[model samples]
Target: MRSGLLVSGRRGGSGRVVGMLHLRVVCPVDATDEVLAVLKAHPGVTHVALFPGAAIEPAGDVVAADLAREATDEVLSALCGLGIDHTGGVTLEQIDTALSDAADRAEEAAPGEAADAVVWEELLSRTGEESRLNATFLAFLTIACLLAAVGVVTNSPVTIVGAMVVGPEFGPLAAIAVGIVLRRWDLVRRAGLALAVGFPLAMLVTFGGAVLGSYSGLFDRTMVLSAHQVDFVFQVGPFSLIVALLAGAAGMLSMTSAKSAALVGVFISVTTVPAAGYAAIAAVLGEWAICGMSVLQLVVNLVGIVVAAAVVLALRNRRSRTRDLGRPLSNG
Candidate 1:
């Protein structure tokens, strides 16, 4: 049996976190099917898929191999346990060697530390294109934002948090982070357009709903200028920014690590959409100062997510490279 190292990573989708891994191994083509079967038995892996390449094929001098995350641990164990002469298996030492080497190479290839990558045009485009899921998300975000606005006016925390959970905006935001990392310009565009359009749509719907509520006697005049009375008021302060940063970091980490996405509920608690919802209400009610605060809150949260995602991806890339080459520096 052959053995080598595997490094785990992430690939972002519209609302779900995607996992990726790179493996370095020496094994025969005839046994390739057996090798893959063994790897697929691991618990920590999901979305087990393969990308074939000539560079790493083991047989016919092809020098290529790939195993999915589901197969990770078992595959490593099999590699270690196998009697055949080959290279690559899962090990802490192997992983460390790969990551250290990648960091050094990246430092050299980059003119400077890799500045945060933002595929602006692509981001805008992908968000604009309509998809069934994205359209549904848009509708949900509108309803949630509207509900949040009402909750803020009524000074109801429960309603506000309910709106936050119901808001589907985070999915697209996560997609944008993923698209950036994968260099998937199409997805980037889709996510960007969704954000650009979704926010206004949500604001408009909520504003109209607020007006209707006021006319219907369900909403009172006192509610118009309401700010702190609302449970949804933006938490303004350094801590607010800090929370955004931490949430962003966690969100990105969830995307890159194993089973970490289960913590997405924690990220939703950061209150990004709720803040936006509140700000929109302020605008409808002509509360300029409150609106300003809400806007600031949203901006901070957005920046936090993007910045954190980029940092995590950059680190993962470096780590992947180091593992693949078995060195602290790329041959380049």
Candidate 2:
């Protein structure tokens, strides 16, 4: 069975609706006819091309089409059912900018609401890309944690917010959630490894930074200990869990809908960054109690966010399946 479906809808742009997807398919020579038929029959599909034996590596025919994003799931489903995925491959790429009247009409012809659409393949592709464990990911995490540590020592809420905004931890958390919903163990493992290594390295960097700052008389333990704004870092409770849950849900929604502005709120609402910073600072200061509590706070917030995102993604997946089952396939 196909993993999930994408909703197709119109986007408002000076009275022009946009939201088209460009697809490239490598198909076995014998299946080219069926694949071309599938593409040509879809109203949402505007441009179609076929190249016989064009894919040298795969030794197959190449097919390309421009279709409405909403029609992606159905068209892909048809291709998959024909054994295209096993014999060859299918790739979907979003069009960042398009200047075609045909594309606009294709969007209108596609069925469903774009805002309500959930393109599982696209979502998985995107999250998978973001969840990779690499230097960039590590650097962002380390810097974010260090900023959080600075925020703690200075009791600066602005610094804390900046740290939160800079952190890339949410990408892996969301990937984990999507992995669980999709039952993709590989994705789960990748996301888990990224988090496993990223957080500790970030914490370590902050720890070393704190030790140095203290030696230089730049950081005062008393400041963090006395700061009201920084107290939540070491206080993990039901309220903290609630905030993490809500923030995770909102973050997933923003990701699915491409409303990135809401993601900034998600960044600042969770306690992961602050907790990591506090734990590092506390450990350096020999305050074991605060260190333990800060560690617990980090765990709670991470778990809460992951669980909440998973629940939201699973629910959305279920709803998409239901919608797919109820709607009749459009025949162009």
Candidate 3:
């Protein structure tokens, strides 16, 4: 491990807490010195510990350190350039609390505050998990849409809100943007599959449910058409686009910042689930025009989100790269 001036940071005036990351690196014996050199050269790294030949499986040395969150992307990139990511192992964990003046000074030395920093590698890993097409993703989406259909039929905003909060569509959506920004077509295709395959399947399931409910007399066309409170799901308009754009930006930002609370707001703000529900129910009642409009609303929201999120990630990537050019990171 490289040892030197450990950087630390302070909170913003609004009580935004500073961020720290615990990084663990395992590398072959021959690469140990260069890895140490990189850590030693970084101002934002601190509390580095080196254990020679501690790695059993990979059979290498272990290097661990604390870093101001701002420096994580840079340091990881340099290490990857050394091919440690492929040859050995790299892991990261969040540090909730740190009590050291040197750590604070390390943050001060870092280029940016924690809230503003975009750790590309971290974002990619996190979103990569979210974008994977799995049973859980399909299940949640289907359940959320079903809940939303119930909410729409009953004209209950509360139920609709619950449905929105339950939906997991944002994960794949944000992953698409992240993939686009990083030029990871595999990530892009995987996320695209999650969205493309997931949404239609979920909506189809909801449509079947709506049909069953209609036969059982759970809801009829009159009640569905009478639903005014939650009609916003199919109310395609400029504001729909606006809300989607804002929500998409917030959703992507929440992923980068790790502000999960912001995610709840993002989830409730967009109408993806509700729109899908509305479309399914409308189709059951033979309300083709309304169904068409609801599908349009869904498309508008999805497109708006993708566009806004892509722009945000692109700009952040640009800013990070520009910083790299002006002040090159110590790659060792």
Candidate 4:
């Protein structure tokens, strides 16, 4: 098997973190030639090897390559398009340490920015994992809703912020956006189910908590009526939608970039958990008007966030496709 050019280097070592990707692919005998061609033609790729009939179970030849992270998405897309992912297999792992001058050169030769690269399979895998509806997910939702309930009754913005931090609702919301963009109805359905079940279940538990708090005189109709912060939860208007839209877009971008720190801001900015809390408390106090308004606010924010995230993801995918089209397969 022919290999890509590997420049000799004296800087070879081990146990050093580097910005690179190690891709192990299993290619059918028939497709090995085409797969090798693609790998060699791509300048970002280096240190390639081929082992004939190495992979079993799926039964294919094993091909491994070291590449710059910036070029990974394009190479993965190309491989998928060539049906290597179906007839064989493709796996990617980040190199924790690369002690090689050749690796450094490979990184420098790769065009494009690493931060801007979007690994479609990786993104989908991550979001899919987050969309699972399990006890852990329910527990987080319960705690967030309860915190929101306490915040609503005591008018404590601190408690509300804490609830936002604890909440995992955004996972499903983001999954929905990704689903819509990728046209994966199953993802959309699973994410939708998480929301549909999570919210109502949380509200039900919080409603029970509200009843107990009312009996203990910790919460009452007068307190809710007097709490100025409660007004924020009940008010549904243009500003509420605008904030959700902005937060949704930011949340998706954060996920794509893997900068989870930004997601905390997204959680706190949305009214979903708080609105549910307020509605439950209002219902307990027989304040139907407040409850109705709070539910409306919740609906508006959810719709706004989902719509905005979907739009952002769609646009991002479009731009990526356009860029890929304009870029040549070879660096030269």
Candidate 5:
């Protein structure tokens, strides 16, 4: 049975009206088409996705009647006509309650927690069905990490930032966190393996490049210990952890949100690669202090990303549960 439904609406106002409507309906897959047809008839509905067993919950703030009465009435009439039950009134509280309920059920149907860690595996399973594990992705990762290492060695903020924009490691890490929470061993294994294998390889390759640069006169003592304007260094306080935490959260949001993936690149810029490059440079120079700082930076980023992803997924799950509790009608 389908576990949730989401319906959304918008209203026009005297000045400029911005309205959003979302609904969650729980029904079996066989009945989904009928339910979808009914929902499609509602006005001002922009997007609707159907996940048969996914979690759905009510979302958004309650709209004030003074603001959305006309649009609200039009939506109410349409819903009643289709035999799709919905609460009336344009109060913001009511709207929030309604949408939240729908979203909860949607989440219950397909929990993402267990699947989080195995993101690569899941991606492979999904895309591999259509195409082979393209070498392009791996190559890109390697190149990006190498560039970031170079950026650190040169103390070039621009190069390091560029490398961050190119790094694609966050997705796999997020998957691992999700896998860990959901106790999905497969996902955990895939994510863990990717991290274990990919991380060291990236570090090693980048280190080799740094060594070559040292031999080639590209690296110097000042560059080795110098922290870029964009790089986070050791002897640092809590701020590094905060940045990592926020970046981690944003990364997860980008992954789950269809329209928000664009922000993921920025998130990457704030984490991981720059620190990696710094570590490689420190190692090549035998700068213990700098190496320690770089290692701390890396650890901070890794922990922040993992913790943030896990917490965000867990919160989403809880909200979905709340919506399920509030939904009154049974989806047949």
Candidate 6:
């Protein structure tokens, strides 16, 4: 498989494959007709091609096509029901840029605008992996809190924003919402474990460093009391909940549409990491009231995001007739 860098050169100017998927299939020779029929039946799929006897391992025919992002789950469902996954293989890749009129028409032919389409399968897979309680997740969350700690002490908005971007908490938070929408209780439990264990652990680690720094004359109570921006991090109010709700909605939209920039904005918009950091820092300084407030802030943001994201996903689910999508597999 080519790395993402290698695919960058294929970005033609005429059309953007922003909301499309590239599907490659290896199947037994006899199944080529069935695969073609499935691809052709979808109004949102295009650029279908078949190469006979192209597989070296499975030693069968190869079928390739481009599909609208919205149609991905439906097509995959149809294909999977054919038992292609067991006898053959399938691969789906993001098409960053496709400079073809056929691609444009393909998007236009779909149920909704490419940008508004929700590829639930892709979203679930991506978020599910991220929601793992792994060392990498812990590392990013710790680093973010550590950065937030420094930002709180020094009163640096830039550092705070950097911490927000570095934080990986959004993954599990998003996974929780997605899981709820899909009624995937296992996903919810796993993601809940990640958040349940990841945050306090990161905060505990940050708290130790904060205490060590304080004893070494690196921090003081004055720093906590005088900082302006950290004030926002530690304060809980109606607007805090409001901003979180807005960010959560925007974040879900970005996830569904695969919008990178908007996702970044969601990262910066929430104060989860910063609140965790501030709470730890305040605790180290013996400001129990401030620490409690920061913890409350953290809770508000987390709950608001989860509730808001679940709503967005639930609505999208109601709008989609996922089970009835695509044509039934041919018996021939």
Among the numbered candidates, top lDDT falls to 3
lDDT string, candidate 3, 1-332, tens digits: 22233334544322223588888999999999999998989999888889999999899999998888899888998999999999899998887666667667678888887888988888888889999999999999999999999999999999999999999988888988888878899998999999999989999999999999999999998998888999888989999999999999988888777776898998999898999999999999999998999889989988888889999888888887887786776787
Query: Candidate 4 clash total?
Result: 1
Which sections of candidate 3 miss by over 4 Å? 1-17
Index of the highest-TM-score prediction: 3
Per residue, candidate 2 scores C-alpha lDDT tens digits across 1-332 of 12222323535433333566779999999999999888888888877888998998788999988888778888888888888889999998766556566677777888786666677877898899999999999999999999989888988888988898999999999999999989998999999999999999999999999999999999776776887887877887899999999999998998886567998999999989888988999999999999999999999999999999999998988988887787655322
For each candidate in turn, the TM-score is 0.59, 0.86, 0.93, 0.84, 0.59, 0.90
Q: Scored by Cα lDDT, where does model 3 land? A: 0.87
Separate clash counts for every candidate: 29, 4, 9, 1, 50, 0
Instruction: Output candidate 1 Cα RMSD.
Output: 12.7
Check candidate 6 and list the clashing pairs.
none
List runs of model 4 lying over 4 Å from the truth. Answer: 1-19, 27-34, 49-56, 59-61, 95-100, 326-332
Residues 71-163 of candidate 1: C-alpha lDDT, one tens digit per residue = 333345455555323532222211212222322332243321122222222223333342214668778889888878877877887888788
Q: Which window of ten consecutive residues has the lowest lDDT sum in model 6?
A: 1-10
Expressed as tens digits, the lDDT of each residue in 133-249 for candidate 5 is: 235545555677788777766667778778888876675677666676566667667666666666567778888988888889986877655554644644445887888778777
Name the lDDT of candidate 1. Answer: 0.56
Runs in model 1 deviating more than 4 A are 1-133, 224-232, 258-261, 327-332
Cα lDDT of model 4 by residue, 1-332, tens digit: 12233335554444445557788999898888888887888877888899999989699899999988778887887888788888999988766566667687778888766556667787898889899899999999988989999998888888988888888988999999999999999999999999899999999999999999999988678787888965788898899999999999999888876566999899989998988888888888888998999999989988888899899888888978887786765422
